[model samples]
Target: MNLHTWVAARGGIAHREDAREWGYSPSRVRAAIRAGEVQRIRAKWIATSEAPPELRAAAAASGRLTCVSLARRRRWWIPEGASSTVHLQVGGNAHRHSSQAVLHWSDPLVDLGPRSLTTSIEDALAHLARCFRFEEAMMIWESAITRESLDIESLRSVQWRDESSRALARSVRGRSDSGLETVFVVRLRGFGVPIRQQVRLAGHDVDAVIGSHLVIQIDGFAHHSTAADRGRDVAHDAELRMRGYTVLRFTYAQIMHDWDGVERTVSSAVARGLHLPPTERRR
Candidate 1:
């Protein structure tokens, strides 16, 4: 296959510099783009018509599938917006690419070993951790599990000792409180409240959402996550309130220790918002 085909097969170039190494004059690259033989996905790389197909093969073979595409492919993670960049799990031996597909670096030990890269449902969830902030990542995690994208083997396929990996694993366990929330689940349970875990409502979801009371939201501490997610959260809550729902948000810290307090507040707000009498709410 030609260089363009090869790059396309590899899911486009990681960046523009890689294109130069392929020996295409700048003008030629632009001309190819105009002719529709190639396309510039990101500033860095030119994608040949075949790039997407190549990316799929490489992702399966590279053994480290990125969350953005994997999530879409495996139905693992879902987000409100389309991911602009592609995420890949690459090892030391993997050569650099000349495409906009952003490859994530990792040191997998054996082909199927802890250090070896892998392609599976879990990798998609793991990729979300690296690709987005913790809060957003957890949302993907919750969505995957709630949608059943995560599997028992997929969980084991993860290398937990690593911080990012571990955080993701923990997050999965955290949001999936269906009789399995603690180590993470405990905090939610301690409220002496009955939580409807992984429930969908009015086209939005709540992790351990309380019915007939209040809606509780859990947030993680991903860096640079607040400002990015704030407006979206407000809008989401506004819609929920419009639907006759009262929402209460809790962060990781609140869930960790003061969980009871958070629950109490939720319970109170839910009761008050619904205008239910005290005895009626405890049920």
Candidate 2:
């Protein structure tokens, strides 16, 4: 491929050495720069005008994107109202960076190669634990687990540097189908009721099961937007109800924005023994 196409294929930015290996000589690279096809970044990286701003900023600052910035790029679910600031991981000795960007100075959890413009997923999760609250960080981590197919046991074995990272590694079950599910599970941990996630019941995989008979289904917009999808969900809820399961469905807004109401409804259901089987409730 030609220089511009190659650069664009690599997300509109690439290392000079990678370009050379791809058969572009130094003179050719200089010609491309002179012709305004690509802009040189700190003598090692080059970017087209269409490059992502966060990536270009990372290259300019000689840092790798990490924390929520990288999580956003990877399409990981982040908490609402999380900071939009560009987060970069720079070497402890490096000094130059934009004041508006948040710079992480700690050592990376994994080594980044020369051509890498972003931190590894492990490093991103580590930084996230430090940058956000526990619940928010868990949301991102569980999203990563689902999106990246991360092995939970392997994650727990890593030598995470921070107490937050260690706690996250130990606590993450990796069973959440979405970040919202993770939030629901984490927030209800104190109920002292057994909670199982991704449980198969009535020939369908429900979101979570509280105690034994309480089936909680969380609907995210991406999955429940279409009329057909909503119809299918309603049918499933009817089937689950017919099978003696106490189904509680919550929307994305109710879970994220109206948690108090959601909690109260759930607490009432549990207190009334709706989560118990008929025999158990009668006893």
Candidate 3:
């Protein structure tokens, strides 16, 4: 591949070694930079002018994007209120830069080979497991599985150094359709709430069922924007409530932007005994 194509394919930035591996000679690489075809991120990294800002920053920092930084780019669920610092992975023997980025100085479980701008999904998950809290890591991992970005079975076979990472791999399930649902499940779990994801009820697949009667539906913008979709969701929720089940619906905006409000709403329902099964409510 040509230098421009190779750099663009790797998300806009690449290491000199990766560029060389792509059949671009050192002189050609230098010429590209001098001719404004590419911008040098550091002594060893270069980016096309059209490359993404984050990838260029990662290259400038002398690291490949990984952990939460990579996960955010991949649309995986990240922790609420997490820092927006670029997370990068560098080789164990590589010289570290002093950029204001989070760096993981470890050997990746799976090498990127010629792909150096970002870590592979497997390596990102491994780093995520080590760096983030259990709930956050599990949410991201579950989101990855939900999107089929990585196969769960293949991930299962990979060894984990951190106990939390191992737990995350074991806990990931493919039923949750969105990162919102993943966060919701993990958050509810902390409250000792018994919840089942993607529960089939009344001919519709609800996002989650708590206790035995409370149903939760998570709507992302991509799925529930149209008037007909909103109308159908309202009808379904009404039907569920009419069937003696309490229903709670949250939207992408509410979950990601107003999580405190979301938590309060759910917590109030639980406090009012709305989440309990009929038998449990009586007790």
Query: Best TM-score goes to which candidate?
Result: 2
Q: Give the per-residue lDDT digits (tens) of candidate 2, residues 191-257.
A: 9999999999877899999999999999875663678877888898999888788999898899989
The alpha-carbon RMSD values of the candidates against the true structure, listed in the order shown, are 11.2, 1.7, 3.8
lDDT of 2: 0.90
The whole-model lDDT of each prediction reads 0.57, 0.90, 0.80
Better of 2 and 3 by lDDT: 2
Clashes of each: 19, 0, 0
Query: Which residue runs does candidate 2 get wrong by more than 4 Å?
Result: 93-95, 223-225
Give the deviation of candidate 3 from the true structure as CA RMSD.
3.8
| After superposition, candidate 1 runs with Cα above 4 Å error | 1-64, 109-118, 146-158, 173-194, 198-212, 215-268, 271-283
TM-score of each predicted structure versus truth: 0.45, 0.94, 0.78
Cα lDDT, model 1, residue 151:
66
Tell me the tens digit of each residue's lDDT in model 1 across 1-283: 4446755665464345555666766776777678777667544455665545535434333435567766665554454465656566676645465335667676432345422233555556656677777655665676567667446455756665357767666545535642123323444445454566556867767655554546666675332456757887788889977866667767656655575776577657755644233346454
Better candidate by TM-score, 2 or 3: 2
